[model samples]
Target: MELLFLGTGAGMPTKERNVTSIALTMYEERGSFWMFDCGEGTQHQVLKSPLRLSKLEKLFVTHLHGDHIFGLPGLLSSRSNQGGTASLTLYGPPGIKEYIRTSMQLSQSRMNYELNIIEIQEGIVFEDEQVSVSARMLDHRIDSYGYRIEEKPKLGTLLTEKLNGLGIRPGPLFGMLKRGMDVTLEDGTRIIAADVVGPPVPGRTIVILGDTRPSEGSAALAKRADVLVHEATFAQELSDLAKEYYHSTTKEAAQTAVEAEVKALILTHISGRYAQDGAQLLEEEARSLFPNAYVAHDFWSYEIPVKSREEI
Candidate 1:
């Protein structure tokens, strides 16, 4: 799995950054892509990348703010035009259904593919065989939510050496052992899967916070997260302004990462007030509190490498 940031600015689009959108690339896990916060002109941003709206299986909207969801109608309509024939599911707050339904009705846009709109609540927003998603309320002007995505664990690797020692060659027998089945050879010797496989590899956890102030909810949402995407709309010098706006400061965002013990933190939703040099200064401030804090920019992507149990 990997995270591809389509837009990473706050409130409005800047020449240096767009609004707020991130694509969770699940090409390997789900054979599709999932997105969070389709900010304004998000479709335009996707057009510049390899990700396709047709392959966009799931969308998780953090809030109903314009910068977070103004691009829904455009993206959904363009998906059909892009020759996408697959069904799509969108998860968001209560107003998401009304917004999409009304917008589509007003625009007289009909889709060729199935469109499933889910009014998101605090519990399990999405769950399938491969991945599960949950959300929590955040401190914002409206009913904002923070999302937590957890991928399911994969089965352990088959030990070819162990199998070869038992006179079993790699073939359909390896497949059977990997599927947790016992196999009996022509010589009446039985081989159990446990004896020929290594330990199961753990999956990845990704946490994304919408606009919000400091809260335990952010910490809980980030527990053991491999990558945490948090909003840092203001630098430490603007702590009072950040609190007034119900947004987190650089220090507050970093502390949440430290408290949650996340492996890394990507600070997004930056204020345009921070120019190129300010980006470096803001990154430095966040990292001083938490070494893993990283300032996010538009179109930045990172992959989660698969590692063995010992490597982790």
Candidate 2:
């Protein structure tokens, strides 16, 4: 899986960055991509990237802030116009349904595909055989949430030597065994999948948080994540301003990464006041507290590698 930052700026758009929109592209894993937030001009950003509206299967909105969701209507409308006939699932906090519904109604927009909106609560928001997502309320000005996405453990490799010894060659039976299913030979010999398979490969975990001040909720949701994406709207020197605005500073974002013991920390939602040099300062400040901290810019992408069993 990979995270593509479409707009990393906080509140408003700037020459360097747009607002807060992220795309989690899983083309190899699921043949689809999931979006996080959809700030103004987000479709324009997508036009610049390799992502396609037809592959947008899911969208998880953090909050109802203008900077976080203003481009939803336009993006949704464009998806239908661009031949996206597949159903789209959206998960977000309460009032999201009303906002999208009203926007579509006011604009007289009609979508050819089904739009499923789920107003989320503080718990498991989505789950399937491949992945599970849980949400927790963060300390934002509004009811913001942080999501923990955990990919399910993958099946281990099938021991070919062991199977070969049992008079089994690579075929449909091997596929079944690789999937952790027991298979019986034509001669009635039973083969146990676990005995001939390696240990399960550990999955990866990612935590993505919305705009918020430093809080336990952020740390809790980010526990031991492969990567933690947190908002750092200001530098350490602007701690007072960050608190007043209910946003996080570089130091606070780094502290959460440390507290959660995440492998890497990516700071986003940067304020426009921070120019190129100023933004570098924020990264330096975060690295002081957490060496793996990185300040994400617009269109920057991060790859989250799947962990091996030994890594776990």
TM-score, one value per model: 0.97, 0.98
What local lDDT score does residue 24 receive in model 1, on the 0 to 100 scale? 90
Clashing residue pairs in candidate 1 (N, C-alpha, C atoms within 3 angstroms):
none
Give the alpha carbon lDDT tens digit for every residue of 116-152 in model 2: 9999999999999999999999998899999999999
lDDT tens per residue, model 1, 85-146: 99999999998999999999999998999999999888888888777899999899899999
Q: RMSD to native for every prediction?
A: 1.1, 1.0
Identify the leading candidate in terms of lDDT: 2
lDDT of each: 0.91, 0.94
Which TM-score value belongs to model 1? 0.97
Worst 10-residue lDDT window for candidate 1 reads 303-312
